[model samples]
Target: MALRAVVRSLSELCITVGVLIVLFVVYLLYWTGLRADSASDDEIARLHKQWAAGPVDGGAPGGGTPEETGGSPSRGQDTTGDGQAGGTAERGAAPGTARGTAPGGYRSGNSFAVMYIPRFGGGWSKPVLENTGKQTLRKGLGHYTRSAPLGAKGNFAVAGHRRTYGDPFKDFPRLRPGDPVVVTDGDTWYTYTIVARPYRTLPSDTGVLDAVPAPVDEAATPFDRPGRYLTLTTCDPEWGSSHRLIAWGRLDATQSASEGKPDALTR
Candidate 1:
């Protein structure tokens, strides 16, 4: 009878252990994602508030607007000889030739810009924090520090999780060539056109973050001059990080935030 009792107690212990394991899995998969979403929302709200407040003359924390800084239009604006509004001109620098300058130097975990992918959905947008570290990615997409600044003449690369955390790039695989990936620095909307299909590479590959992402396929070409480019990197295979998937794009247009949402964002 004593031996039987010992076997029954062991079975109960096993059952308890199994239950705790399941609960831990649930916490990692669901609770962490909820936490990430809440953090991202808070960061975005803070950025909007800063932009709404407008910048201080030359000493503002977020920097001044293009007009105040003597910079060109964030996006191309068209006007006839009489200064009346004309339709958007071809995607190029405006007469004064100013592009969206970096907001200011940001710390590792601070959000500096917002990203919108119309291909994902009209409502799809994410905060872009300054660093690619684990903590920054958990809050939102992480901008690679060595890459170009947003709306500038080099590869503006960013990284995000594919499945866990908020799964910011869960739909990354659905992006196709010609799709629009738009970014805003609170003052301007910079639209990028996806140049080709996503290609897979080893996680160790850093060329994907080059000034012009090295051509992966026939669709890509090396850019000799300074040109606005973008590169998105995420883990492949949905649930693992054995490799990375990359998508490339080039700036197609720029518009003022005062003009309202860009056509890529509209229905």
Candidate 2:
């Protein structure tokens, strides 16, 4: 009789432990997402406050004098090469007015820019923080430290969580070729078009962050030489990190923030 009782007690203990393990996984998957959403909201609020207070010294690099619209200097022009002349505005300088210098040194938690993807829906945007560390990514997208700054003649790469931490790139797979990925640094809006379908690779494949991402297929290089490029990265399978999904884009047009939001944001 004692042997039977002992066996029953062990079985009960095993079931309790199993239940607790399941709960922990649920917390990591769901609770962490709540925390991340709250963090992202706070960071975006901070960035807007900064913009409203006027441009910060050593703000984003690559700003230049305002562009000429008609007879006077305007905030910015639609340099998209599509012949759509953006009207003048009372605020912000034009693209290329500020030279592309080294971006100011920022710590891990600082919010630097706002990224918009039209294909993600008209209201989709996320705060881009300085570093791609555990803490920073929980707030929003994390910029790769070694990559080029926005609108520069190199690759500006960023990473975000696919399944947790606000899941900033949750719909990454929905992006199609020719989709627009727009980013603004308070002064200018840089628009990049998706060059091709997203590619998948092992987590160790760091070449996706290269200045010019090497061609994945034999359909010619996306951009022949080193020009402004943007790369978005996230983990594959929505819940696993064994592989990575990458999206590539090239700078297509630029406008001043003062000219109003880009069409990507409006549509």
Candidate 3:
């Protein structure tokens, strides 16, 4: 009788452990994603509301001067909130300027733009927040602080999560050359065409954020000259960050927000 009792207790304990593990997995995979998705949507809506209200203090329609908006760090510094300090490109244009105008500032942790990838589907859009910190990425895609502004003449790099935090870039592997990644700063719509499929590299390969990312090999060279570019980065293996995945693109076109949505988004 004692042996049977012992066996029964062990069985109950094993079952309890199994149940707890399942709940943890659900929280990580489902609950966290739901929360992140809602947060991203809220950020997008906030940006739209700000834009509709018009530019304040002569800044971009939805932006303000860095002093007023709590701007990010200057160029060549670690604005990503990550420990690395590598980017050397020119500072991003002040927030809220049309193409060809002087660069504006970015309020760290704030959403300055919205990105839509038709390849990801018409319903897919994510807020592009400043600073690629751990907490910033949980809200949406995080822009590399020192990279160029949208449609600017330098590398405009952004990062997102692959498996959690709403899995914004879970489809990172599906992106291909010729795909379109459209972004808007409430004043202009910038369309970028993917120059090649995703590139995988070590997390230490900060050159990918340079004014012009160096080609990994002779045959895979994407850009050889300075120009406006787009880069999307995420973790590899869907559930692991052992490697970094990247996608590069060039500014294909730009249209004023007054002109209606870009064709890349309409079609």
Candidate 1: 10-residue stretch with minimal lDDT: 73-82
Candidate 2 regions with alpha-carbon error over 4 angstroms: 55-101, 215-221
lDDT of 1 by residue, 90-177 (tens): 2122323333354323434667689999877777789998779898898899999888889888889999989878788988989999
Local accuracy of candidate 3 as per-residue lDDT tens digits, 1-267: 999999999999999999999999999899989999999998898777656654342344325553333122222132344343333233333322332223435656767789999888779999998889998999999999888877778899999999888989989999999999999988789999999989888788788888888745445557989999998999997888799998999999999888999888877
Candidate 1, position 167, lDDT: 81
* Candidate 1 local Cα displacement, residue 107, angstroms: 2.7
1-267, model 2: which lDDT tens digit per residue?
999999999999999999999998888788888998887787677667555544433233335322222212221222212232332232133323342224433334566688989887777789887779887888899999888888888899999999877677889999888999999877689999998777887787787788987744435346678889999999998889888988899999999888998887677
Candidate 2 lDDT at 221 equals 49
Report the lDDT of model 3 for residue 259: 97
- Residue 157 Cα positional deviation in candidate 3, in Å, after optimal superposition: 0.5
Regarding TM-score, does 1 or 2 come out ahead? 1
All candidates' TM-scores?
A: 0.79, 0.78, 0.79
Give the best candidate by lDDT. 3
Candidates ranked by TM-score: 3, 1, 2
Q: Estimate the overall C-alpha local distance difference test score of candidate 3.
A: 0.78
